[model samples]
Target: MDAIFIQILNGLDKGGAYALIALGLTLVFGTLGVVNFAHGALFMLGAFCAVTTQKLLTISKHVQDTSITFFDAYKDQPYLEIWWGDFGRTIIDWSVPLSILLTIPAMLLIGLSMERGLIRHFYKRSHAEQILMTFGLAIVLQEIIRSIFGANPIPTPAPDIIAGSAPIGALFGLDEALVYPWWRLIYLLFSIITVSGVFAFLQLTTFGMVVRAGMHDRETVGLLGINVERRFTVVFGLAAVVTGLAGAMYAPILSPDYHMGMDFLVLSFIVVVVGGMGSLRGAVAAGFLLGLLQSFASMNEVKTIIPGIDQIIIYLVAVVIILVRPRGLMGRKGVMED
Candidate 1:
């Protein structure tokens, strides 16, 4: 039971990232009728933001080291001095969460620019064309990040306060190895807050009301003199920022690398499909469900029975869900279009 509980916690955080990513994809599809292949790239970019911020924060200084513990180390008369002339390690050791925060506005701007400059032109393009264009864009974006940051997995160090394994099992007076890391718990909470805020914004705000209306009928809303297009652009940027924030926060739990987005993009699509192509609630629920199940599938017992269950868990769930509900858990009629 304890083992199961820990796995459940692990899944929630992983699934939360998926849910958030899928939600953004659904938003773009639901509101704009365009399938954004760039969504995952945005996610990738968000992770890279952390990578960039970490690199930016590093106070790199060349240091000559003579073993301070050994007095004879300087017997060769070689003097060691810290170069870059500053304490580069001090700032990094002090704050990591701050970089994630700095990543938000940066990602939001990136999102806005992508929307205004590229996606705006595709609002009326055919789905196939949009996919091709955006996929190409994603490729370009990934390559750009790779060129700049290299292909290595970038480690995002957690804040000093929450730097180690949390011992979830230890809290229950169990064993030591069953500990959960604080960064992951923080991730789960952060995703929840983000999901909640977006939900609340849509449910409680006038702007959200307008956006929802625009989602249903851009033509009708335009007829009523609403700036439907402008709201959509805002929403696009919002979706980008949301996904970017998710990616940025996720960087610590999962390594931030240029290719990480490609890994997440497929599952996110599956999550959206299983949740319902346009349903936010469905996306959130399905993300957790799939994440939990996937976590369980990796267990020795489950894998022994199903062999390679980890790789197949999501696809299996997607198949069953799609078969059970053709339009998704909450898809509206005609939203899938012809």
Candidate 2:
């Protein structure tokens, strides 16, 4: 029972990131009908946004410290600390949290630019063309990041107050040995909140109504004197922002690296396919389902029975779902099937 609970928590943690990325992918596909292969690159850029903020906060200068000269002749003090003392140190220490401010605007601008300058031109093009061009763009973005930040993973830690593991089992009246990372719990909550907010925004707001209408029948909405194209552009930007924020939050959980986006991209694509393309609810559902299955497959008992089942579990599930549903778990009549 304890092991089962722990694995459930682990699965939810993994699923949160998967669902968030897949949600954004669905938004872009539903709104613009564009296969955005570069969506993962946007995620990578968001993680880098956190990294960049950390770097900016910790800009340092070498100074001679007569009080301490054991390791080096000069001591490095972050400019923020050197200038503002404890407050600057606080900011530097909380770099991960503070970076959210930087990521939002950065991702919005990047999304808008990509849509206006590049993706807009290819909307009427074939999916193959869209895939090729976006894939190329993703490669280019990743290469640019590599050139700037290098190929190594950069660790961005959570705040000191929540840096350790949480005794999750205690909350459920179980053994304390079943502990989970505090940040992972926070991430799970954050993902839930974000997903809820998006749904609420779309369901309750007038703008959301317009966007939804445009998505279903663009020509009809445009005939009603609405700028469907502009709304679609904004939707694309919103999708970028969603994916970017997910990446930003995940930086502390997994170190940000140039290739991290590519790693998640394939899995997220599988998630979307299994969930049903263009279905927001399906994406979220499939993400958690696969996440749980993967978690159980990793159990020692399961692995003992079927060696290496953990690795292939997700793909196996995807294939089964695809073969059974064809269009996906919740896909409409003529979505990807057409």
Candidate 3:
């Protein structure tokens, strides 16, 4: 029972990230009528932001023990360390958390630029073309990131206070049975809050209403005298920010690497599909549901029957759901077509 709960928790976190990424994808697809293959790359960019900030924090102008022959050979001074001073110390200490703020505007700009410069060209093209071009864009983005950040996984440490495991067993009246990591718990709460906030914004705001209106009928919205293009652009940017934020928060748990975006991309696509494409509520439901399902798949007994169940659970669920309901749990037909 205890083991089962642990797996469920694990799945939820993974699923949460998947769901968030997928939600963004679905929003753009349903609203803008473009298949955004670069969504994953945007997510990758977000992780890179965290990694970049982390790197910036630790880099220094002060040379490390130059007594080492390696430093002598490289002749590299830790110039940034000296250049940054206490500012660097503060950054090193708080960059991971602070990165969320920095990545938002950056991601938004990238999202808008990509939409206007790259994706906008394909808006009038067939779905197949959109997929191909966007997929190509994703590849390009990955290559660019790899070229810049290298192909290594950069370690992203959680803030000091949230670094270790916390005892939750006592709260459950079972000592020594239910410990959880503070970071994991914080992430879970963060996911819930973000998901809720997004849903609320869509449900409550007139601007969100305009975006939703544009999604359903871009022509109609345009005819209604609203600038559909501007709204869609913002929506595209919003989608990027949503996925980027998820990626940023996720960096600590999963080491941020150039390929991490590609790694999570498939699962997120599956989650979006399962959640019914454009349904906001469905996306939230499916994200948590899939996360829980993934968690359970990793349990000892479950894995005993099928080793590495976690690896296949998501694809399996996607297959099963698609076969059962081609449109998804709450999908609306033609939402992806403008």
Model 1 bad stretches (over 4 Å): 63-90, 172-177
Instruction: Please write out the lDDT profile of model 3 over residues 93-163, one tens digit for every residue.
Output: 67778888788998999999988898878888998999999888899999999999889888888877678
What would the per-residue lDDT of candidate 1 be over residues 258-300, giving only the tens digit for each residue? Answer: 8777778888889988888877888898899899989999988
Report the number of clashing residue pairs per model.
1, 0, 12
Candidate of highest lDDT? 2
TM-score for each of the candidates? 0.89, 0.97, 0.90
- By TM-score, the best candidate is 2
Per-candidate local distance difference test: 0.81, 0.90, 0.80
State residue 52's C-alpha deviation in candidate 3, in Å.
1.2
- Between candidates 1 and 3, which one is better according to lDDT? 1
lDDT of 3: 0.80
Q: Rank the candidates by TM-score, best first.
A: 2, 3, 1
lDDT of 2 at 35: 91
